[model samples]
Target: MNTLNQGSQKYDVAYLKQTIIPGKTTKGQITQMFGAPTNEELNSTSTSNESNWTYEKTDEGLDKYMKLAHKYVSTETSLKMYETSAQLAKAQTVANDVSSVTGTKTGQSQTQGSVLTIYFVDDVVKYYRVY
Candidate 1:
């Protein structure tokens, strides 16, 4: 017999969002304040400013996994983005480097937003956030 217990924890996206003011803050600054971000972007423009910085705090899900004896897969519960012109510039640089290395196209048609998806197979994490 298997019993499941999901432990509760505090998650505040608003508080995280409050840590920085977009356009004024850089990705480095945001990371310094909030630690390494799950993701980072650079060289993008925002309505408020010409650049943006973003990060996400994902639930580790270990607690839930253990509770269910690793039987269940979880999806992202929440996500947030931060804006900074400096960060956007940096992200653009990094993306350029990646494209150069992979011989991929320099620009994507969709500039507004990027989507990430994670795939699993046989109850194991396979690939994630493949754009």
Candidate 2:
């Protein structure tokens, strides 16, 4: 049998658009919705002093497999069961060995995460970008 498992953590852009308004949303409101930012920076420009808040998210994928094989080695071995007792013995030996052999294989993949940068002016959201 084979199996696959995938996991991820991310932000909702549409939800952000609805919740974060350029002139109305405050730093406290953004923090409430997204938790603490991954990183923060302050900038002083000719006309404005602003802050940049960065948020990040990641995704991962995985694949798993199981393999099994069995072999029976006996002096009394035959292809026709009813024709000979040797065939029955060989069949029994194979059935007995079936539980002893097995193997497993696993594979994994990952994707680069998404990043969102929110620019704040006077503690209010000025603009944002997602990549």
Highest TM-score: give the candidate number. 2
Tens digit per residue, CA lDDT, model 1, 1-131: 12221211112333323543433544455445544434434333433223222332232234334435323433322111122434776998888788878888444422222232222232222333322
- Model 1 poorest 10 in a row by lDDT: 1-10
Which residue pairs clash within candidate 2?
Answer: none
List residue ranges in candidate 2 displaced over 4 A.
1-10, 59-113
Candidate 1 to truth, TM: 0.27
Worst 10 residues of 2 by lDDT: 62-71
lDDT of each candidate versus the true structure: 0.36, 0.59
Alpha-carbon RMSD, candidate 1: 20.4
Model 2: how far residue 7 lies from native, Å:
14
> In candidate 2, what are the lDDT values of residues 20-98, reduced to their tens digit?
7898999998877677777899886625679999875431122111111112323233233224545766886665455
Give the local distance difference test score of model 1.
Answer: 0.36
Per-candidate TM-scores read 0.27, 0.49
Clash counts per candidate, in order, are 10, 0
Model 1 clash pairs are: 42-88, 42-91, 42-92, 43-88, 43-89, 51-84, 51-85, 52-84, 53-82, 53-84
